[model samples]
Target: MLKAIIMLILGLSVLAAGFITLKRELSIEAFSISSADEAKSEMKNIFNDQRWFYLSGIALFMQFVFQGFHLTFEYFFYAFLISSGIQSLFYLFNKKELDYKVCGVIIVSFLVIYL
Candidate 1:
């Protein structure tokens, strides 16, 4: 129960950070990755086209329901959420590019988180 609660809090925090990173692009933060401020094609593409996150979230929730919120599942999911959030921040800081460096960070972070 305690582990699950911790995982929920961490996952939600990371997910919120990811959302904020994406949202920052839409604002006039001077680090905008949109093709044009007037048109905002990139922002639209990110907001409208990202469906995997929704699917993953639903899948995890379903698994939580089915497994009765197993601790192992929550631990892994929390790690994944944090990794994704860190990657989003990395991409946001690096001109919205998901490069090898971000991938490396994901890999390293997961290994550290799991092991």
Candidate 2:
């Protein structure tokens, strides 16, 4: 019972985080678009922003949901792992700096898998 509650909370939190991040990155302007041109511009900006955070948040939330339901969740974890790995590589390749947060995600993911 406790585990299920925790899992539900975690899932909701992740989903909320994704929405909050998207809100922060785009601001209210994202919701105030008045034309197709403005919408397209916002879409482009969103795509170029820290999109991986929200994407991975969704994946993690799904994993938690699956676990709560006593269903398979490994696929969601793998999805998160692959996306996080790619995002971290992009950080390294583009900025010539390792994204420690993403690296941490990768490490946690591996630990989750093995342990």
Candidate 3:
């Protein structure tokens, strides 16, 4: 049915975004390793590694669960918005640069779905 197809597409798109965000975060962490090593001269703690990725992944997974429960495009869209907001908050907390373009994409995608 149309609803199922839309949900599938939305889920896949969100998952793809999450994966890309994770990849970017990992790359940044790798870049920061040298600086961190110079500061501490010790092995990095895994708990402190790639925190944004973990947080974003959790938020995205929660969105996925919410979407799956509703089976409606609107719910999926809202979930995406909420997930993006959560990710933005994580970025803010980490004092890292935020991507307004990515946030715009999420918001625009949700508006499109709502329409």
Candidate 4:
């Protein structure tokens, strides 16, 4: 019972985060649209901001929903691992460091496969 409740809360929280991030992105999009030519000039920065965070939040929500509510600690751990891996991969890729990207991708891929 406790486990299910916790899972529900976490799932909702992740879901909320996804929505919030999406809202922020929409607001930014609106800004860009209203700013005329200036927005297009800085298109790169606007689009890239916080996109990964929103994606990972959605991934986290999916992890719980797909795994189903359970009492086992492994589910919780795996959910976190997958969510974290997604976020980390986003970070590494964004950093544009080849060595870190290679290692991070390998680790994330292995964890994702386990899912």
Show how many residue pairs clash in every candidate, following the order shown: 0, 0, 0, 0
Q: 2 or 4, which is superior by TM-score?
A: 2
- Which stretches of candidate 4 lie above 4 Å from their native place? 30-78, 81-115
Q: Candidate 2: where is the Cα deviation over 4 Å?
A: 1-12, 18-36, 49-73, 81-98
Candidate achieving the largest lDDT: 2
TM-score (C-alpha, index-matched) for candidate 2: 0.40
| Model 1 lowest lDDT segment of ten | 49-58
Best candidate, TM-score-wise? 2
Position 109, candidate 3: lDDT: 40
User: 1 or 2: which has the higher lDDT?
Assistant: 2
Q: All models: lDDT? A: 0.51, 0.54, 0.50, 0.50
TM-score of 3: 0.31
Q: Per-residue lDDT of 25-49 in model 3, one digit per residue for the tens?
A: 7887444545755656544453454
List candidate 1 stretches off by more than 4 Å. 1-72
What is the C-alpha lDDT profile of model 4 across 42-115, one tens digit per residue?
78666774644544445445445555644356644545644554444444335545455345434443444343
